[model samples]
Target: MAFVPAPGYDPAYDPPVPYITAIPGGLRPGMLFYIRGTLAKGYTRFRVDYATGQYEGSDIALHFNPRFDGRDRVIFNTFQNGAWGEEEKKKDTPFSSSRPFELVVQITQANYQITVDGKPYHEYSHHIPMDRVTWLNVKGDIVLQAASIIGCGVGSAGSKGGAVGIPGGLPPMVGPVCNRPAIPFTANIPGGMIPKRTLVVAGHISSGAKSFIINLKKYSSNDIPLHINSRMIKNVLIRNTFLNGVWGEEEKDIQNNPLQKGQFFDLSIRSGDQNFKVYVNGHCLFRFDNRIKNVQEIDTVEIQGDAELAYVFF
Candidate 1:
């Protein structure tokens, strides 16, 4: 589900765009947050970012992409690079710019409940937890003016700590998973199997770095692939797939890996789960222990230098 914009929604003329805001790197499980804003004209994409001061980083987490009809409905689609497609608000669609609208959502250990303008709309359940999100963004020129967060009060008078397995007192998880502005890959990861490079399916295929990487998920394991990302998938496994180079040869390393200057890479998946845990050079870097669980299995791994992709195993 994609959206253009209302015919002429203006941010400056309308009330200041309410901020779709959240704390970065501190999302815990079981919390509620309020995201209120005006659907002023000219708003197209809505995204959430977690890495402060830096737009694109491997450390960033969660992004939500939504579309509006510019009439009477606003839709919040699910997943970044995986399936589950789009889900629309049931009660009060806020696609029209005629009046102001607000959306409030509660995240529990088991599911998510949404309320638009004080009325309940929909609830989604997940096996993984949603409490792991830290940053949020809204894109497509839409302006959000104000925002607030509410904590789940299960263990204390107003305790906002995440669930049992994770640490305590982390920020509420409202990270967005779609509508993110595209950032380019900064490192020249050797394509295909190159010499002196270890091959791994995740370093190339899991990062959403390019159109080719996106298409890699569709390649099948039975000499062809289908899907990847960490979610509720069990039983099936993917291993040792080879990178096909520009010459169709298993790629080999030659030059020092260098990306186009001013280019940066982003790590995100189509699944709503925030737990696409990543590591660099055998060191654990980012772990999205939140609820957005959609895992992928990769085969035929490849790499350029000293790096280990054991975490991609899920």
Candidate 2:
């Protein structure tokens, strides 16, 4: 499954070196993290850690260290109570200095699966409880470009016919996985909207685009619980609801518009108990309070207007 940056956790772009931040909601079995950076020329080593706390000397659940001193190797270990656990080493390194690289780390029940530049790299078994890992620390000689965390569904390693431990307690109803889906697309949100359920829409805006609309509607009625209209020409985003053949007041206030003409975007809408949180390109854009109390009735998603879609996942 293609993963967009998870809503509620902002993606870091061009972040400073030695970045340390809390992993919002912590590490769950289905969570995936993506990191992209360029190794500094003539670099010696660099490391990324999933830690229990942000402070130095805090226990580290997983330590991923790539070394380039005399022998190029990657070391994996755990740190607890001022001691390092036995090290697991991979002899070959998939990274090179002065080159850009993409690394993906996926959390599973048994191990951390690592991928480098789209290839399976290594898997390190858990030495510390994953739930205790609440922080991510990246340091050493690399220029970090981007880092994001996203949900890719539960039991991602293939468990059949069982309830997932996610908040909604339902198997992910991720759909069609369309590639470049035709404009004016619509899809069903099976089992209806519930708190902690997330919808992801990824695509590129048409160069001459003027506007686009995303609507969450009831499958059997004309009522729309949420309608998002983005007007590129006016640089405004409008949010409203339609009920009883009438539209509610429009919400136009936002921090800043993140949409632009001819640019790719990953838009996420995460349902919460009281409101819907909207994020674009990994940044929270705004929140819309629930106008319709019964969200389970909002079962259909419709998209239209001047944009080229990559995919829509619910």
Instruction: Kindly list the per-residue Cα lDDT of model 2 for residues 1-314, writing each as its tens digit.
Output: 22233333335667888988667556777667768788986689999999999899999999999999898899999999999999999999999774567787878899999988667899998888876887889999888867755553443221112323343343354343443468789888887888657787766678899998999999798799889999998999999999989999999888687667876567888776689888876678888999877787889999998987655666
- Model 2 CA lDDT for position 293: 74
User: Alpha-carbon error at 185 in model 1, in Å?
Assistant: 54
Model 1 lDDT tens row, 127-170: 22344444444445455543434332223211122322222222
The Cα local distance difference test for each model comes to 0.32, 0.77
Model 2 root-mean-square deviation: 8.7
Model 2 reaches what TM-score against the true structure?
0.56
TM-score of 1: 0.34
Which is the leading candidate under TM-score?
Answer: 2
Number of backbone collisions per candidate: 79, 0
